[model samples]
Target: MATANGKLLTVPEVLAELGGEVARSTFYEWRAKNQAPKCIKLPNGEIRVRRSEFDRWLESRTEEAA
Candidate 1:
């Protein structure tokens, strides 16, 4: 299920978008370390990442080959 533009993405959706390159545990680890993209914590305690922010974060990760 593709996330619509500007929609908020769940952990699983973000993982799928990364092609499963990173494990779910690693994602959580990143969150804990504040290394992942900014996320929203819903009132119920669920975490969500905005599509636009995720896209920006992903783009920022791009590094020119040495």
Candidate 2:
């Protein structure tokens, strides 16, 4: 569904897009620490990660190789 942040991604989709190395528990741990992309908690209790926010978060973590 399109949110204010545009397309929303499920946690599984996000993990798969990240190459399937990150576990749900790990992602949740990062979320609790405010280290993962910003998420939306729906009425049913499922979480959604905004595509734009995730993109921006990925950009912020980019490193320049020396």
Best model per lDDT = 2
After superposition, which runs of candidate 2 have C-alpha atoms over 4 Å from their true positions? none
lDDT of 1: 0.89
Query: Where's the lowest-lDDT run of ten residues in candidate 1?
Result: 1-10
Q: TM-score for all predictions?
A: 0.86, 0.93
lDDT of candidate 1 over 1-66, digit per residue (tens): 235657899998889999989899999999999889998888999889998999999999999999
Clashing pairs in 1: none
Per-prediction backbone clash count: 0, 0
Each prediction's Cα lDDT score?
Answer: 0.89, 0.93
Spell out the clash pairs found in candidate 2.
none
Q: List where candidate 1 sits over 4 angstroms from the true fold.
A: 1-5
